[model samples]
Every structure is written in structure tokens, then in C-alpha cells.
Target: MTVQTWTFVIVGLTFALYILIAIWAKAASTKDFYVAGGGVSPLANGMATAADWMSAASFISMAGLISFMGYDGAVYLMGWTGGYVLLALLLAPYLRKFGKFTVPDFIGDRYYSNIARTVAVICAIIVSFTYVAGQMRGVGVVFARFLEVPVETGVYIGMIMVLFYATLGGMKGITYTQVAQYCILIFAFMVPAFFISFQLTGNMLPQLGFGGKVADGTYLLDKLDGLHRELGFAAYTEGSKSMIDVFAITLALMVGTAGLPHVIVRFFTVKKVSDARKSAGWALLFIAILYTTAPAIATFARTNLIQTVSEQPYASVPEWFSNWEETGLIVFEDKNDDGVIQYVGNQEKNELTIDRDIMVLANPEIANLPGWIIALVAAGGLAAALSTAAGLLLVISASISHDLIKKQIKPDISEKGELLWARIGSVLAVVVAGYFGINPPGFVAAVVALAFGLAAASFFPAIILGIFDKRMNKEGAVAGMVVGILLMLFYMMKFKLGLFGGGTKEEWWFGISPEGFGSIAMLINFIISFGISRFYPAPPEDVQEMVESIRYPRGAGAATHH
Candidate 1:
């Protein structure tokens, strides 16, 4: 079959499967909608959590970023992986033991104040919306190339499909669908790696293949380094970012992972505190299958890209080049009126402009891989984006319906009314998310990193203190979240979005980029929270006792709704 036919078939089957699961596991109650009735087993939850955690950023964009950024991309790998460990070990069990529906529920109950819950809900919405925008953008990119549609049209399509499943089934549906998505995406990601690995180095393991020798007995990394030097670019193995920036970005990502409301909510779906821990372990194993392969895939994609296109004749470019060119992801300008393509590092001399987001998607075509394998990649990219988008949309809807409306505005609202409101919230959230998708702020990974910064700045400190410190009161948590999120927003807008009289890179505060500034904001939050809490009286006696109770593992029951 042709690539388009294969894409349609695979994508159609996967979509049908997801819709079937959504119908089969449709959420009937507020508890089911929110936490899948809190009866999910560890293994299923593990697969679901891994799928939810690995969004478009991981599937379509992470390897692409690593291909272009070279060694500097390690921050993302280290930060995100380390952050998951921090969340699973330090936060998940405790939160599950607390038996709350959402992060806002924990804060509200722990602090004994609706005000704290409101603040947490706002932060959750902001963070989840920012993250979901990246997922939608990923969907648009995949559809633009494989489905041969405009990016806006693609976003609309993705929004409709997600809206159908998410509003209909909620967490219950999303969880089971993600389990299937994990299998598809992981298989899709690895098949190409195996093929490319053996074709390049006579080895099936991509990890070993990248370090192995080619047919001419030249080391793969050495050849890539030689290519970089010949093209006036830095060596692929050398780092360009400063040590402090790398450290800050890594730390920000780590803590941000812990604070991400969507990922944290995954633990709540498990049966008990121990089950949450077990799912975390299972999730780490499932997640590692992809994370470990990414660097190898990055190397393979980068090497193939440079060898295939650099200084090649524009007229003789492969079918894949023209295919992507029609999508506007690959641009050839013939700047010097020469027939040759210049893909150099210097912007002025580079005649070929390639979008980084296209590297992973285009890798198979560049290497002359089979059509079916290439089409499978498109399906994988969609699975990754849709899975995460569903999870984030759930977080946004739950924040509005469960936290803002039911808990605060109308405490007397019936269960059916709350479920209706939750579905309504899902519709509104998807509309806003689609707008951001159609008009994304940046490329996939960059937009996702900014969302992580926001999460790190706002939620990490409050959640940590709420659990570890008995004296951490509502006033302090509320103040810290407000200031932290505001500071992050200011830095992100001024630097990343170029909004506040947009300054140049040279004007960065303390020489930190916007992606890494979350660490500084998080630290400030810790300080402000500590400082303000001292002025107020300690938390109520029962609140303190509850805080201490969650620290232990024994006697913890199933996750509760309210």
C-alpha cells in the first residue's frame, strides 16, 4: 500500500479502537469521571500513566530537539526522567493516601481553606492548558503531513475526536485508551529504530548501533562530528549551554514534573497508597523503553538528515523532501541562485530551512525505509498527542467542575449536575486549547518546557510544604502560588513570548533562559511561603494531624472524591 493508504488504515483502526474503549468504559458518576472509580490495578494504571506522561513532546518532538540541539538536549532527558522519579517516590503515595480527587482537593482540605484550593485550581488550569496546546499542535503537525491537510484543519479534527472520548468517558475512558496507546506508540517508535539501527551498523539495538561502526568501520559519532566540523557547526557531542543554565533547566523540569497536576492525578486512580507506588514503578519501566531509545534515535535521525540533504542538488532532492516541502516544513530558497542546497549552521548561508519538529517524522523517509513503517510513525505521533491531550483536558475540566463549581460555588449541587458541569468544562477547555493549537506560541518541545516551568514555579512549593510541614498554613500557600505563578508568567512572557518590551538574549536575568527560570521562581516561592507562614498562626490541630497522617503508608484507603 502507499504511505497515505497505510496511514489512513492504521490511524483509522487506532481511532476506532480508542472510540470503542471510550464507549465500553464510559464514566457514569462524578467519581468515575474524576478518578476512574479509584479501582484501577497497578499494571493497567502503569501503562496509562506512561502514556499520559509521554505526550507529543516525547513522541514527536524530544528526539527532534535532541537531533538539532545535540548535547544540550540532555537537560530535557535528565530533568523529565529525574522529575518523574521525584514525583513517584516523594509525592504520589502521599497524595494517593490523602484520598482526594484533584490537587486542589488536597490543598483545600490540607489547608482547611477554599481560598487555597481556588489558587491551586487556577494554577492547574494554566499549566494544563499550556501543556495541552503543545499536544494539539503536535496533532496538527502529524495531520498536516500524513493526512495532507492544513494545520488548522488538523487541529479542528483532533479537537473533535478528543472531545468525543474525553467528555463521554472522562478518566475511565482515557485510562484504558492510553493503555492501548502506549502499546501502539512504543511499537511504532521501536520498529523504525530497529530497522535503521541494523541498516546503519548491522546491529538491531539502536543504543549499541549509534556507538557501533558503519560499513566503512568509522564510528557513528565520529562521522557525525566530522560532518558538523565540515559544515561549520559545533560537534554533536559537545555542549554549548552554560553549566548554570543546564543545571537550572534540569532542576526546573524535575520539580515541574512532580508538580504537574495531570501526572499527579494518575496516582489517584490506583487502588491504594501501595498500589500507587506499584504503578509508579511499572510506569517508570514502561517510560524507560522510550526514553532510553531517544538519544539513539536522535543520533540516527540527525546523521541521516545531514547525509541525505547537505549540499545536495535541489532538483534531485528525494520524494520525501518535496512531500515535506509542500507542507512548508522543509523550505528551499536557492538564496545564491545556485542549484545546490545549503543546510549549514549559519542562518545567512543556510538555503534549506527545516523545522526541528519534522526530524523524527521525516527520518524514515530520509533513509528510504518502507512505506508502512513511515505511516506507522504518523499513527504513533497521533497517539502520543491525543493521549496527553485527553489527560490534560480532564485536568482542566475537573479543576472547573470539581474544584471551582461543586466545591466552592455550589456545594449543594447534585452528582449528575456536577458531571454535567464537568462535561461542559471539557467542551470549553477543548475550545481554548484548539485556539492555542491553531496559533501555537512555539514549537512542540519549547512550548511544553515553558509549561513545565510554570508548574515548577507555582505548584511544587505548595504541595511539598503542604505535606512535609505541619505549620504551612493557607495564607502562606496561597500567597506563594500567586507570586510564583505571576513571576513565572512575567519571565516567560518577557523572554519567551517577547511581550514586555521584548528583551534580547543578552538581557536575560542572571543569564538564565526562560525555560530554566522556573527554578529561581520555585526557590522564591519556598522562601516566601516560609516567610509568610511564620507571621500567621499554625494550621488547625486536625489539619496538622491529617498532614502527619498522610506521611505514613499504613491504613491508607482507596482514593475518595470529596
Candidate 2:
């Protein structure tokens, strides 16, 4: 079968499976909508959490970034994986014990202030939207290639599909669907790796294959480094980023992972605090399977791309090249009117332009893998993007409907009314998400990294202080979050988004890239929070007691609304 035909079959089947699961697990009450009725087993929640955590950033873009960025890309690997550990160990159990459906719910009740809750709601909406933009873009990228549709049309399709399941079954549907997604994505991710690994180094395990000898009896990394040097690029094994930037980016991603609202809300779906902890462990294990394989895939893809394209005649290039070229991701200009390709690193001599996002998607084709394998990757990419998009959309809707409308503006609203409002909010969010998808600010991993920075800057400080500091008051938490998020927005706009007339890399604040500036902003938030807290009265006595109560171990109990 042709790759497109296989894609239609696999992708169509997976989509049908997701829709069926959503129908089977449809939510009938507020609890079901919010936290899947808080009865999910640890194993199921763990698989669902892994699917939610991976995102398009992990399944599609992480390895692609690594393939192009080489050594510097390790920052993403370290930051994201390290961040998950931080979240599981430091935040998940306590937040589960607090028994809240959303981050704002915890912030509001713990701080004993509706105003604080409102601020948290705004932060949640902003962060979730920024993250979902990357997911939507991932969806568009896959469809544009496999389905041969315009990226705009792909975004619209993704928006409609996500809206159907996300709004209809809410978290109840998303959780079960994610479990199935995890299986498909993991299978899709690994099969190609295994095939390519054996083809290159006679090893079925990709993790070891990249380190093993290639056909010429040289280590894969050593050969890549040789290729890079020959092409006037830096050695593949050496990093170009400064130490401070790497450290800052890693810290930012770690704290940001802990602060992400959609990921945190998964912990609330479990039955008890202990269950949350158990699920966290299970999730980390499941996540490691792909994380370990990514570097190998990146290495293999980079080597294959260079070997297959560089110096090859335009007419003689593989069929995969022409297919991707039609999508405009691969451009061959035939510089100097020579028949041979010039894929050198130097801009002046380079004749081939490749988008880094295409490396993973294009890998199986480049290596001449079977058609079914290529199609399976397309389905995996969609599964990864849709699963996380659903999760983020749910957070956006819950922030508005549960945190803002029910808790503040219309405290007397009935459960059914709130559910209706939540669905309305989800629909609105999908429209906005689709817009960002069509007008994406950057590539998938880059956009996602910025969202992590935003999460780190805005939510990390407030949540940590709210949980651990008994004296933390609403005035300080609210002020800190506003300042932190604004500071992050300013930096991202000026540097990342190229606002404020756009500055050069040399002009970055204290030599930090916008992606790493979150660490500085988070530090300042901690400072501002502490500095202002001394002037205000401590939290109310009962609030402080609630904080203390959350700190201790307790019997396993269902998540609560109080």
C-alpha cells in the first residue's frame, strides 16, 4: 500500500477508537467531567498521565530538535525529564491531598480569597493556550504531509475532532482515550526505531544501536561528528550553548513541568493521595521508554539525512524527498545551477533547506522503511498532539467555568448549568487554539519551551509558596503571580515573539535567552512574594491550619471539593 493509503487506514482506525472510547466513558455529572469521578485506578491514571505528559513536543519534535541542534538539544531532554521527576516527587501527592479539581481551586481555597483564585484562573488560561498552540501546530504539520492538505485545513480538522471528545465526555473521556493513545504512540515511536536500529547496526534495541559500530566499523557519534566537521558545522558531540544558558533552561523546564496546569490536574483524577503518588511512579516508568529511545532516533535520523541528501543529484534523490518537497518543508533551489545538491552548513553555499520538524516524520521514508511503518508514525503524531490538546482545552474550560463562573460570578449556578458553561468554554478555546495553529509563532519544540517558561515563571512560585509556607497570604501570592507572569510575557514578547522592535541575542537580559529567563523571573517572584508578605498579616488562622493539615500523611480518600 502507498504511504497515504496506509495513513488513511491507521489514522482512521485510531480516530474511530478514540471517538468510541469517548462515548463509552461519557461524563454524566460534574465530578465525572472534572476528575473522571475520582475513581480511576493508579495504573490507568499512570498510562493516561504519560500520554498527557509526552505531548507533541516529546513524540514528534523532541527527537527532531535533537537531530538538528545536536549537543545543545540535550537541554530539552534533561529539562523535560528532570521536570517530570520534580513534579511527581514534590507536588503531585500534596496537591492530590488538597482535593481540588483545578489549580485555581487549590489556590483559592488555600489562600481563602476569590481574588487569588481569579488571578490563578487567568494564569491557567494563558499557559494552557500557549501550550495548546504547539499541539495544534503538530496536528497541522502531520495532516499537511500525510493527508496532503493545507495546514489551515488540518488545524480546523484537529479543532473539530478535539472539541467533540473533549466537550462531550470531558476528563472522563480524555483519560481512557489517552490510555489507548499511549499504547499506539509508544508502538508507533518504537517500531521504526527498532527497524532502523537493526538496519544500521544489527541491534534491535535503538538505545544501544546508536552507540554501536556502523557499517564502516566506526561509532555512530564519531561518524556524525566527522560528517558535521566535513560539512563546516561544529562537531555533533560538542555543545555551542553557554553553561549558564543550559543550566537556566534546565531549571526553568523542571519547575515549569511541575507548574503545568494540565499535567497537575491529572493527579486529581485518582481516588486518593497515595494513588496519586503511585500513578506518578507508574507514569515516570512509562515515559522513560520513549525518552531513552529518542536520542538514538535523533542520531540515526541525522546521519541518514546527511548521507542521503548531501551531494546527491536533484533528479536522482529519493522519492521521499519529492513528497516532502511538495509540502514546502524541503526546498531545493539548485544554487549555482549545478545538478548536485549543496547541503553544507554555510548559508552562502547551502542549496537545500530542511525544516527541523520534518526530521522524525521524514526518517522512516528516508530509510526506505515499509509503508505501514510510515503510516503508523502519522497516527502516532496525531495521537500525541490530540491527547495533550484535549487535556489543555479541558484546563482552559475548567478555569473559566469552574473557577470563575461557579466559584465567583455565579455561586448559585446549578451543576448542569456549569457543565453547559464548561462545554461553551471548550468550544471557544478550540477556536482560539486553531487560530494559533494557523499562525504559529515558532516551531513545535520552541513554542512548547516558551510555554514551559511561562508556566515556570507564573505558577511555580505561587504553588510552592501556597503549599509549603503557612504565612503566605493572598496579597503576596497574587502580586507575585502577576509580576512573574508579566515579566515572562515581556521577555518572551521582546525576545521570542520579536516585539518591542526586536532585540538581538546579545541584548538578552543578563545573557539569558527568553526560554531560560523563567528561572530569573521565578527567583524574583520568590523574592517579591517574601518581601511583600512581611508587611501583610499572615494567612487566617484556619488557612494556616489547613496548610499544616495537608503536610501530614492521611488515610486514602477520594478527592474533595471543600
Residue 185 in candidate 2, Cα distance off native in Å = 0.2
What is the number of residue pairs that collide in model 1? Answer: 0
lDDT string for model 1 (1-562, tens) is 8899999999999999999999999999998999999899999999999999999999999999999889999899999999999999999988888888899988888889998999899999999999999999999999999999988999999999999999999999999999999999999999999999999999999989979998889999898999999998888999999899999999999999999999999998887788999999999999999999999999999999999899999889999999999888888999998899999988899898889899889989988999999999999999999999999999999999999999999999999999999999999999999999999998999999999999999999999999999999988999999999999999999988789899998998888999999999999999999999999999999888888777864556654333
Writing each residue's lDDT as its tens digit, candidate 2 over 40-83 gives 99999999999999999999999999998899999999999999
Most accurate candidate by lDDT: 1
lDDT of 2: 0.93
What lDDT score goes with residue 478 in model 2? Answer: 87
Per-model root-mean-square deviation over C-alphas: 1.1, 1.0
- Model 1, runs deviating above 4 Å: 556-562
Candidate 2: which stretches are off by over 4 Å? 556-561
* lDDT of residue 209 for candidate 2: 99
